[model samples]
Target: MPQATALYTAKTKRCEARKKKRRMTEPTQTESPDTTPLILDVDGTLLRTDMLYESLWAAAGRNIAATLKTCVTQWRAPNLLKHALCEIAAPNVALLPLRPAVLDLADAARQAGRAVHLASGSDQALVEAVAQRLDLPGPHFGSDATRNLTEQSKAQMLVERFGEGGFDYVGNSNADLPVWSKARRIIAVSPGGTLRHRLEAMGKPLEVVEDRSDPFALLREMRPHQWIKNLLLFLPLLVAHEFGLSVFLAALMAAAAFSIGASAIYILNDLLDLESDRLHPEKRNRPIASGALQIRNAMIASAGLVVLALTSAWLVGPPVAALTLLYMLTSLTYSFWLKKRRWIDLASLAFMFLLRVLTGAVAAQIAVPGVVMAFVFVVFFTLACVKRMTALARDVDHGKLPGRGYGADDFRALKVLAAAGIVLSAAAFLLYAFSGHSGGLYGSQMIFAATVLPLTLWLFRVVRLSELGREDYDPIQFVTHDRIGLMIMVIGVALVILSL
Candidate 1:
């Protein structure tokens, strides 16, 4: 069965090549002076654009309030605030930060007297824009709104531009393999998965070029959004009147240190999960998993991140430094053993949230209220539970959780656990608001804050929508964009301010 499957795959690939060949008019035996012979894949090859797409879509949703009439018109919007915010929100992706080595390769190729042709399955306009930015000469090949330049179309374009055995090709996917095979020198820039293994098995003359682990993937693996969980550390400082210049500086430094530390952990996690991540749906694009980033380099980046974080912490204060160390230690534990165990994993995540609150307290040099810490614990625990539930739901939707210790069957139990967490957290909040420490102002404000119940109900609705695949996969985004959720949040904030 395995042999047949592999053979069938190979046959299908061959058929794809034949169709591509049929699409093209014969290439000139003699080349035109203006034509570039070298072809580059756009998405992962020439420039990073996945985050850009995400940002665009996210912005579109955010702009749904503004009622964008057309795609081109949206691009024409004078204010690029949402665009800029999108970059900040998903730096690992939106920045489409170029890989240094690929730039070097392009420079080397250009210097060698080869013309660069940008060919991507993404939109032609995007490809053209990037090519222009990179200073590649005119006439790039890419998918258009009308005709997608993917699969056979991509291959056909390559063949048309560079006759069989005429040009060198650079690419990084199984989808690219059929076309890449047509190149005289096949540069598999970060190749892996079934494609890499199959090519190796076929004894193709392929040279693999990789950057340090993909910065984006490395960044994601670290779950930097979880750094927002560290914002809990800031709440204590905020409540304690630690928002002055010096205190703010300390908090900023602490946040920076934590972000760096988290990024480092991502480098390590990718190194550890290289094989498993490859099988994952979304994670497969990661530098380490895709072979675009080297494991050794990822390790080095990890070390650098730690050193930088600790050094920054030391500059802040001894107490802050100590707290940072604890956070780092906790993260290490989560990475190694905690992530594998079920309830323990969620507990560890909640604990990390609590520590961030402590770190904030240390940064502000104030003792956080116990009630505040308890509230953070409950809130973060609920969020953590929801994350697990989302994962389990995704597993059920997809029929498997290929990279994590989960399966489709776990979805029901996970959802129930998540619901319980939400209930407990809400109860804790209500308890804290009504406690003896709760001042008269706080007690009065509790009525307004009670509005959180409806908000929670809406959030629950959104989460279930996400599980049902209607909401965005990003939880933070889901919260930020859900109309009812955002309005409730605004009301909650108003109540908190009134109490303060």
Candidate 2:
């Protein structure tokens, strides 16, 4: 079976842009008769995503053992591997982002008594399923047990079925150039970069249907705003009062490495949450969930980001690299299994934050205080509960929580847990006021201790907003847009400077 290497992969498929009105470049004035079949490519033509990658992720996320077993047994045959994966975890056709332009075109053709066909490099079973989903009446073709049908092979199939220059084709990539060469008419739907010009180079009259995808979608998918959480990596340096260039650079390195690595994990989480995210009120709008980004492209980006993170961490020294790897492994574990378990998910989230602080200390060669670790654990645990509370509260407002395993009866326990966590975190913050580490490092320990008042008030406000369902899923991002959060942050920073 075709399989993903990672544990439970995430999928963020965008549908909005794929269905938008297209900007036509040139209309195809076809000379072909009504008897001619209108052929469509499944991946990136009828759908916004590639079925191969989608099913692979689906299998890895939902049916890992079956998929892995198939992979080990059928690794020699590409077609068999693909068919095996589909049997294990075929994507929900109803949930896939079917391109409206292509669907509309197919409908118009059908209304005119013309035949419509599905031809793709995806496995034959999947192609037939897609044709069945459309209820189209005509032939459908895909790669079989012995051969992968693509490029020249696809061109050959069309030639044998309809003769060279007898069929009309809709395609979106350079790989389709060979197929287009034999078609009487060509239609391009949201063609990849430079594909239009290349199609034009073929000297064939082209009908272009453009879907204006966000040019910066990949960056948005990386979620740069959430990188602010990595700023916590500097906590050890600040608390240690180590302003030296080497240590400062070390802290920055650790933070950057963590930021990139965390993004990879977030992408994984997004993929695994695809179906659930589609049901969510707010999460459905995310670039990945909304089909604003392609699944294969997201996977490629995630893999690249993982490499960048690990290489960067290695540059930060062995200890930092080890810690970064630990964080990533824990995050993947959380995504794959721990998240499905009660309380364990929240504890893992909190522990991840502690790992960040610990990595910072290791990178900067700082001797971390015990209270600092305690403060991180309780405070982040409180925030984790706050996140859950915010989600549950929204469920109360919306009547259902899409992906959460929690229900109405669990709400009271969640509140109690959050409340207890808040009280404990507050107690920890108070202890920070009297921490011997602070007094020894800061010039004005009293000023440093005074910062606690605003910090405590900030935490309280965060919890209150969560209770009201006014906070975003991510507290850090919510704080970025919150005036009170900014004010408290400014005051806290000023107080820290005075202490320094």
Candidate 3:
């Protein structure tokens, strides 16, 4: 008990010393008589994200049960919760997204010989770390063990330090209203809703820094374009020449179910890969990575999508519902574990694609020929290899892929394997076209063989583009947008229809 008391006393003294040093060095309104001090809010103002949520996400990623237990224990003690979370999952200061405009504004204010202070509702330790990382001017204030500095508390503290209307304030949310009322000048960053209306009532802000991101950011996060891959579910119906109303409707429902389930997986993957995504050049702009969408909202959306998918699949058929559940489980496993293992990730992706075709067959109540199943697996497996090759090719630095076993050096071997996969897929198609089932399904099996040519050409084109380091890492997405690929696909489909 005495040792614990001594440790507590030492920590208290250190905190007091730091506060005293800040007070002596940082200029208040009285010390800076010639220039008005500029006070800035941190979360959603100076930075694109809230530190509290970021820390909590990291904590949850580490151990969800332990984090939840800590939350329950410290439910009534905000400061203790903050400390516990910080200790569990401190953010990488260098990777935290910063608002360039806000930083520029602070820099300009400092250049004009004005004192700039960072005041936030976040823990003082976090606030201080952020300020130090950015090399911001003057003292930074934040909630400590004894106080949760925000709203009225923030306003009161600022009023006492700088006096009413003695400073300029920059912030983004409704929580800043009290501080704004106390400031001489108000600068708003990405202000909207009630905050915008209140700022308008007070007249135009000194400056309004607009956030330049797509309004359809949430839709983009869902990646509707990628839903085209789910159309593979219709392939079984097409192959079986079963275009009946019931089969068509069932196929469509299955596609919808798969799309929703895939979206949930995508959201989960994004959340798990937040740190790596931020480090990635292209992925950093993703909604969750860029802080355009809240993690909490994303989690809720993922859960809702999972439930909707299962329900939709159940409406389609019992077999389809089982397949959908299997797909979800496989995808979740791949995302959390298998994706990091060499060869296993590619195999899992191929299996997933095959599952779509199998589910489609079950949905349409059709028994796909063994040769047709072989063809589907080989084709999708090849396409999966192409996807990975493209990703590795574009990653030019030869650096290891985050959370994956592949690297740039593996590109050559992958290309050879992908080529082999393409050849095997063509062989499977040929076998199917020559089989007895082909005679039953088509008037001229010879015409069905024509599909192999276009398929071969499209696969080669995909490989070439990937080797050239093209932007379309997803071969499915590439085919959807590529005019020549689309034309080839149309001709191929037409040939199959002619044979039918």
Instruction: Give me the candidate number with maximum TM-score.
Output: 2
lDDT of 1 by residue, 1-500 (tens): 99999999999999999988876756647654533467777666655333234334334333433324434444543224333434332222223446566677778878877787777765455566677778889578765444556667777767876687677777777877777666676777667667668667645567778743444655555567656655665777666655688887888788778777877876666554544465556666777555455444556778988999999988988888888888888877676557767678777888887887788778877776687688777666766666766666665355655435566666677667767766766766676677655554353746645755764675477557745755554577667677877777787677666666
* Highest-scoring model, lDDT: 3
State each model's CA lDDT, in order: 0.65, 0.83, 0.84
Q: Write the per-residue lDDT of candidate 2 for residues 183-243, one digit (tens) a residue.
A: 9889998776688788888887789988766778788878889898888889888777788
Q: Which of the predicted structures, 2 or 3, would earn the higher TM-score when compared with the native?
A: 2
Q: Is candidate 1 or candidate 2 better by TM-score?
A: 2
**Candidate 3: worst 10 consecutive residues by lDDT?**
27-36
Model 3 ranges with Cα > 4 A deviation: 1-34, 59-89, 123-125, 143-147, 156-166, 181-184, 196-213
- What TM-score does candidate 2 reach? 0.84
TM-score of each: 0.55, 0.84, 0.82
Encode model 3's per-residue lDDT on 313-406: one tens digit a residue.
9999888999999999999888767887888888898899899999998998888888888887877777777877777777757788875788
- Model 2 worst lDDT window (10 residues): 5-14
